[model samples]
Target: MTRIPHEMSGEPNPLRALTLDRLRSRTSMKWRAYPEDVLPLWVAEMDVPLAEPIVRSLTDALELGDTGYPAGTGYAEALAGFAEKRWGWEVAVERTAIVPDVMLGVVEMLKLVTGPGDPVVVNSPVYPPFYMFVEHMDREVVEAPLGADLRIDFDALDETFRRATTGGRRAAFLLCSPHNPTGTVHTADELAAVAALADRHGVRVVADEIHAPVTAGGVDFVPYLRLPGAENGLSLMSASKAWNLAGLKAALAIAGPAAAADLDRMPEEVSHGPSHLGIIAHSAALRYGTDWLDALLAGLDDNRRLLVDLLAEHLPVITHRPGEATYLAWLDCRALGLGDDPADVFLRRGRVALSSGIPFGTGGAGHVRLNLATSPELLTEGVRRMAAALD
Candidate 1:
């Protein structure tokens, strides 16, 4: 496969630059999970090629035989620099720990704050893993379902937090910043309110910010720790989602000032999970992949608009509100007369696989999450297939 060069003026949109023949040749789950007839847009993986800097960094490591256990603050430092520059948020390097990936980091963070059988709060119509991981750890998941607008519902959150902490029992809230499926980016005010509520109820907060770098232009992505009263919060961040490095597993678990000691309690063996090559690739992406990320975001923005137009032209009954971040679109398809899981129908009838809404919990019923990170041709075909499923 010919490598697409870094984003440049006159360059085709990265999302549109790749061809179906080239994409189908790949072996990733997105390609292999379905037969050639099925357009697989169900997973969060982006179809873009790796950024030049990441490729160069990994290549140099392999050629030099530098593959070994990771042993430095380089990844953390790179993420700190990226955070400071991108969001004007300062990250105290000493307060961060390298984890295997965002989900594992979240699991470790939850372990620090809650015991088995303790309640973990999540905003539903959320990433399904939030339920799976927490339950796997023997913890209970409590839902504070997102409001009708797909944004956080403060009243529901407050009540849920109150219930989770009844009788002075400890609890944790797993926050999905720039949320998945729905792609609702929580505002600063909303986060501040969350901090106040968590503080009031004695519930610890852990945020998954894997999609931080994928926000559309003009949207401010706020770090949870940046809010006052949130000094006890923890956040799991990674470049995997934005840079298409899911195969490379490395992430940072950032601690708020007050939670530094809690993070210090994480077992040493947990740090051994990340691959050295993963660290190298993630560090390169954070340190030097800004231009490529910006270009990808531009392509994603175009794809978002393209999806809106396509859906309107074909699947007119489906309602989509474009999110400010992430490439996933949360679509409401109840009016189409499809049952609870529309994705099943689309896949069986039209051979276009989408994320089933039922697995996402609560408001996920009668909805489907569409990934918008592919070329215009593929996205259009996916939409067309979805529409044909109705016939």
Candidate 2:
């Protein structure tokens, strides 16, 4: 696990220097979803190269012909190391289990905490899959819309929790730390309050902290389980989001002290869903990819700031209040008068694709989630096209 020194790293800008032509040549969903003419800024995927450690680990696995079912606690140990080093959080390897991906892990955790037809609380304008997967499990969704500042509205959350558990039915709260589509990272105070409310209402909190390592600038991402009264919570984490290893498909489900019993009850077959190669890649990432992650985070910080300037210079009417985490930018498009779905208009007129906000549930209409995890040139061009669409 040799770490690369910052001065020795040769790339002038690891993420910003990429050209559109180079990116368009690839066949990923972001590139293939639209015509060559359109700039794809809709998906959460980054346009950067894979981390060296992950590449090396995957190549080694392939060369050795060692691709089989995943085994051992190496992935969990690597995660524990990363958590201790990065967040000062200690993970008990025994209480953690591997899953195919973060969303699937959440689904399983919800099943363990609540029965089918039970209520699950979530914040509105959240990750689209939160709504989709909860409904897919025959569970009801309870929305607690984020406040105007794009942070958690504790009052709304308490009310939603009360409503969800009114029937003496236990509910599960699916929390998205450093919330998606808005990039709002929850503060320690905010998370502690959430724990208090959930504790009072006898609700189980399952935190999706997949974006924990990618937090930008100086924002402190509070892992939900670390707060007081959070001993009953479950957290889903992955190296995929930060290291651009989504295709590898590995994630971890961790349980707090009180919730360890619930995690222990999860079916053994659920662990079989993880890919062996995916585990290897993710383990390598946590153990050896910190430098690469640091560089990527630096680039993301720049892109977020660059977006503010781009929006001001090009699409003045579109207001972007930059959040402290994630490469996603939530743009307020109400002033543009693009009807209920601005993404549709942008795709047809501007040749620029953005994630439609409508699917993120209430408070999402008149908005679009733009992916800023690409090169500066491509990001600038996307904004330029979006501006031209207005004409």
Candidate 3:
């Protein structure tokens, strides 16, 4: 049966516009890691409260409160169901294993598949972790700087992989889907190109898909496992970013027969150490989050447009692509004349906290990533501050 797409009902809900209220209503505002007084348009966490359904599920679980080790597909089942429902993809329930977070999955995969000194090709100006994970493992990290449009430099990718393979650095690429900081959603063809390259070089693809579920607009995010050579490589998936449950420390590593045995390389003790509560929260989030996700994605579209309009009217020199994923706006702030790091200037002068661009590595120096998962009032206020600082 063919299903018709559904849209949210009746103008926007006012309840949805309450991040500023939440911020103001807090009586005992401690010094937030995100900083106080200055509105945080920085962290990836949405400023909104948890989806009611998720809150209920977690509340119910806490009421039961076993706080013991989680077992069976009891936890991952929600995640598996979500995959089938949302993406039309089926993951073998048994093959999936829990990890504390997506980065751990990447690190573990890097440790398992490559030697100590192997090279990992990361697309530059990419997620900072893409560089850090390889470096932490003492791996040779090669940079594939992004192109003018901020999409992967397929040409640079070709060169990096070729050199890594030829020089016998034994290359493996960390592929970021619906890439972070820049928010470019890689199309199936784009992902296919990546997979083809990895396959040709016999490089494993440790695809970090933490932000896969929150793509903006007409952009479609193809999971690396859904790409051509996915079975030949490894893919990581998590609900942390999509559901704002990063505190839960729940993520999964999805592998096919090609990379199945690699999980064996991790010590038995650490595999067992992931929190039961985190796993339960993960299950609840994945199972009950569809409606909330739909609402949130809709909210993000509004937020993205607001930023574009505000930037156009107030900060005209700044250029931005409508965030195609992850609700983060990548702004070209170099035109505004603050030398080197501009996010710092936005914070110091604008009184608005935003992600610094340089930490995203190569080709990202002149940009600052704006996080838009907040109430319109705060977002508007943030823009006002930015404009004042610049002017």
Candidate 4:
């Protein structure tokens, strides 16, 4: 692996803010000719390509591709190994199954674990998919919006759980670790609190750790299953985001003995044949993708510092609480009068695309989720456009 030299400049790292020179391809924002057409800072995907080792592994797999039915099996072991190696969580390979994606795992769990008319609770201003999954499943979507700082509202959660119990509502909690939009990584204390609530209500819990790998330092993310009552619950994970393999549909559904039996009872052919390519890509990522993860983390750490410091200086009106995880930056654009449609204004007027806060629920109303996974140049350009738009 080749190491790139970086300078801190006593002032601030340019890599910390955003830069465009780290172009991954001709079509991405980095090298695209008419980048002014759209500076995409909305999607969770990074403009950077997959790490070199991951790339090499997939390239080798394609070379051996016969287009024949892939052995796409052995995925559970791969996930189990990765989990044990990364977080010291002892997940048994037998207790795992492959879902096409993390959100799919949520959908499938809804199908099997939740009943129609059952209430599903989620922290508001969360990943929109959690909202969609419940609504699409015909289950009730219950919102437990975060507190003033946008961290989980423990009191509200307790009250909601009690009311659900009193009102004959069996509710399931979908907890997002290294939470989306806000980027508050739920700590073990938070997880334990939620676990106690779920245990009291007999409501199952599913912890979504899809953005597990990219959490900035100084933040701690507890594996949902590692919580006290988590053994009876479930933990959702994936290598796609960390490995830049989102296009490759492969994720893991991990549970303890009881939950494992439930998953085993699922159709024998749940993950039989998949995008042969996805399987090949997923396998390699789990097996040979760690080193690249280290380098990516370094780059992301720099980008995060840049966003935080720049927000403090030039865009004072736009306050940033800083993220604990993921490449997403949650910005407080409310003070700038950037308009109720701040994200839209940024996209249409400033030529920078970003995730709208409204869809993330009430707490995120005047906020915006900006993608910081792109090059430092692109991030800087987007931030520059944002500063100009606000002033």
Off by over 4 Å in 2: 1-12
Give the alpha carbon lDDT tens digit for every residue of 249-305 in model 1. 999999999999999999998899999999999999999887778788878888888
Clashes of each: 0, 0, 1, 12
TM-scores of all models?
A: 0.97, 0.96, 0.93, 0.89
lDDT of 3 by residue, 201-290 (tens): 888888888898887655566667866566767777877887778777777877866777876566665557567777777777787666
**Whole-model lDDT, model 3:** 0.76
Question: What tens digits encode model 2's per-residue C-alpha lDDT throughout 1-391?
Answer: 2323334434445586566778888888989988888889998899988888888999999999999999999999999998887777888999899988999999999999999899999999899999999999999998999999898889999999999999799899999997998999898888989999999999999999999887876677778888889999999999888988888889999999999999999999999998999999999999998878878877888888899999999888898899788889999999999998999999999999999999999899999999988988888989999998889
lDDT of 4 at 131: 79
Clash pairs, model 1 backbone: none
Report the lDDT tens digits of candidate 4 across residue range 1-391. Answer: 1222223212222223333444424453333533646677787777655655567766777787734444634666776666676666767777777776888887776666778878888888888888787898898888888998778888999887777657666678887887888888888888888888888877778778888876675454568887676777877788887777777777777875557766776565656534566766777777776655666666788788888776776687787877888888988888877666688778667787788898887677778899888767677878888776654
lDDT of each: 0.91, 0.89, 0.76, 0.73
Where does candidate 2 clash, by residue pair? none
Locate the minimum summed-lDDT window of 10 residues in model 3. 1-10
Q: What TM-score should be assigned to candidate 2?
A: 0.96
lDDT of 2 at 212: 88
- Global lDDT of model 4: 0.73
Model 1 residue runs over 4 Å out of place are 1-12
Ordered by lDDT, highest first, the candidates read: 1, 2, 3, 4
